[model samples]
Target chain A: MPRPAVEFWFEFASTYSYLSVMRIERVAEAAGVEVAWKPFLLGPVFLALGWNDSPFNIYPPKGRYMWRDLERLAMKEGLPFHRPSRFPRNGLLAARVALVGVEAGWVAPFARAVMTANFAEDREIGEAAVIEDILRALGLPADEVMARAQADANKLALRCQTERAAELGLFGAPSFRVGEELFWGNDRLEDALAWACAGAA
Target chain B: MPRPAVEFWFEFASTYSYLSVMRIERVAEAAGVEVAWKPFLLGPVFLALGWNDSPFNIYPPKGRYMWRDLERLAMKEGLPFHRPSRFPRNGLLAARVALVGVEAGWVAPFARAVMTANFAEDREIGEAAVIEDILRALGLPADEVMARAQADANKLALRCQTERAAELGLFGAPSFRVGEELFWGNDRLEDALAWACAGAA
Candidate 1:
């Protein structure tokens, strides 16, 4: 039987998604599960719920604890983590670029590289230069990818993806979808993989 | 110099708190840090934010992932876990009773016992009989505790604590405060302890 696949629905600006992006492939492979990278924007989703910004920033104590917790978790996982000065960075371009990559079958690698740049290296992902450099390093045509990312069709597709996520009852980033079952957060990666494996069985 | 203490601010109904409550003592002891249990209710905090129920329930994907993640984490930590049927159960009584125990200096054990009953035994904590049994098992006056829990002053105190939590900018349950440094969630327990111990130096 062909292995059932889990769709890893992620946003470029999500911190936990960075961790999952870096590790999900290896983790899923070890567990004998297939992963499909689904890049989408969380901005519209948050706005739909009347949130003007990330909930972590709106709630200070939770935000404070999240940073400290991330530090500990990063250390435990041996992943680099530094709080980016510009949080809730505009992820529209990144999402559009990811959409293009998905068409080109480079979605996973592009997502991982972007996540590493945003979370591990603490780079300003909103800067087109940085993203272009990431694309160039990946041997993709930077100008072509950027042009596609700015195209009206790509933008519309990104919006449609966001709407789809909301329709699926996803209010947060770093969510996973296996058939109709939706799992949220990097912590749920294991369960999502397990569910996908079970479906294969 | 007196060793600085880390305040473990927890909600009695928080599942993550159950894991921390069971293991914090040993972890803190090994790190040579004093842990002060600060029992508080998350209900008022939620209400103040215009939320009618647990964010988990309001956001189904996040809620579903949280339960599954909790199970995986419990297994990793070698702890027992069973999802309670009545989630977000009326924790008012539990919190009030915990406040009473804190005043009487039995907060730690009482907190552990109650958590065990809720998560380990999967008991309906909203039930008066179950709470009474827990209180009796702890060698406390069940009737007296229940009565005190309902008193106007205790109710006011609970409100005050929730207000203080908001004033402190807390967003969720299972937060920790080490001196002036606040760390939120079970994930930050180690950092909280380390910060507390460092302050002692």
Candidate 2:
């Protein structure tokens, strides 16, 4: 029997998601679970809380420790981690583009590439040109996908997804949903995958 | 030359600290770094941020994931972990008592014992009897130490230390400070110890 599928909800601008995106495939495979990529924006969710920025940035100590912790965790995982100069960057374009890719069945790879470019490579994922180049590199129609990503329906779907995330008690990025069980952060991916496999059994 | 001393700031109610407290001794030994235990209340720090409860509790997704992830991490680290019925328990008394222990040079053992009682034994560290029993078991003067813990000077000292933590940009428990470097979370203990040893060199 095939293992049950777990949804990996992520935001393009989230640092932890960058780590999750890099490792989810192998980890899920080892745990004998399938994964579905769900790309959404956290900015709208933060806005609903009446916050204009990342909570990490507002709390310096958490922010400082987070950066250092990321460096250490990345080293342990053998992944590249470069602290981005601008955090909580405008992920609007990235989110929209991710929606288009999800619709085109290229969400996982596109999301991973975008996240690596932003967190690991320190590239500006906010810029349309950067996202377009990434889409093209993935052998997708860059101009056509970019045009569809800017459509009213795609933007509205992204908003609806954000609302769904909030309703499901999600308050951060890099959250995974194994049926009704919600696991947050990159560190919890292994456990979430295990839980999903167990549930399938 | 001896390695420079590193401060291991912790809270009794923090789950991550339990893991750190359990493994810090061996890790610090390998890195040739000394550890000074610093205990303080996270309640006041939360209040300062205008939050009435633990951010994890307020954010259900994060909270649920934290508990589950902690379980997996504990198992992997060969430690016991079970979610306590009462969370965000009053850690003030424990913190104050830790202050007295620090002054008496029994902070490390006391901190470890308290953490084990809370996370492993699933006992309430907030209860006076539980704490007293722990101290008495260690052949310490429980009553006298508890009394000294309430002294005005000790209380003030805890406040000042917390303020210093805030100034240093700490937002959570299980943080380590080596000179000006700050490392957060149980996972960063190894790196923090290495940093301390390097600084001493």
Query: Against the unseen true structure, what C-alpha lDDT does each candidate score?
Result: 0.82, 0.83
The DockQ-derived docking category for candidate 1 is acceptable
lDDT of 1 by residue, B35-92 (tens): 7777788887887777878888886656776787688678878988878877877777
TM-score of chain B of 1: 0.93
RMSD of each: 4.2, 3.5
TM-score of 1: 0.77
Deviation (Å) of A44 in candidate 2 = 2.8
How would you encode candidate 2's per-residue C-alpha lDDT over A1-201 as one tens digit per residue? 666778888888787888898888888887778888778888877776656788778776567777877886788789888888889677889888888877788887888788788887888999998999899999999989988999999989888988898888787889999888888788668768877877878
